[model samples]
Target: MKVLIKLFATFRNERFKQEEKELPEGTTIRQVVAQLEIAEEALGMVMVNGRHAPLESQLHEGDTLALFPLVGGG
Candidate 1:
């Protein structure tokens, strides 16, 4: 399956702020993280298809995925 990924914040800077990516079928968010070679800690906030999702969330074809570093500060 193909999944569209949006990166934000420091994670974006590290990953070159890729707008989209195609993932394999049955790939989980964790897997995507690894595939993209993102730092483990960079798998911060996750949204799948516009809904909050966990790292274990499985990706589906045409799914829109967004990821950002853990938001901090006041």
Candidate 2:
């Protein structure tokens, strides 16, 4: 299956704004992020189709996945 990924903020700096990734059926969000080498601390929030999703959320073909990095402040 093909998944569309969008990286925001720092993540965008590391990865491109939009990317296409291939995965077998039943790939979870966690697995994809790990496969992409995204740091755990860098993962602030996960959004699937514009809604918040957990790491265990199963990915569907042609789904738009967006990941935002954690923004720290004093």
Candidate 3:
């Protein structure tokens, strides 16, 4: 299956702002993060197909997943 991943904030520094990824059936949000080398703790919010999603959320073909990293500022 294939899914679209959108990275926000600092997450985009070392990765594409948005990209398509191919994965086997039953891939989860956590797996995608790991595949991209993103620390789990660095993630702030997750959305799948525009709805809030959890780390264990399963990804499906054509799903658009957005990831936001924790933002810090003084």
Q: lDDT by residue for model 3 over 1-74, one digit each (tens)?
A: 98999999888996899998888999999999999899999998999999999999899999999999888889
Superposed Cα deviation of residue 40, candidate 2 (Å): 2.0
Model 2 shows how many backbone clashes?
0
Error of 2 at 51 (Å): 0.6
* CA shift of 31, model 3, Å: 0.2
> What are the runs in model 3 whose C-alpha is more than 4 Å off?
none
State, as a TM-score between 0 and 1, how close model 1 is to the true structure: 0.79
- Candidate 2, residues 1-49, lDDT tens digits: the string is 9999999888876569999888899999999889878987788999999
Residue pairs clashing, model 2? none
Number of backbone-clashing residue pairs for each candidate, in the order shown: 1, 0, 0
Q: Count clashing residue pairs in model 1.
A: 1
Off by over 4 Å in 2: none
Candidate 1 local lDDT, 1-74, one digit each (tens): 66678888876665666566666678898887787788778566789888898888888888988877777779
> How do the predictions measure up, each by TM-score?
0.79, 0.90, 0.94
**Which candidate tops lDDT?**
3
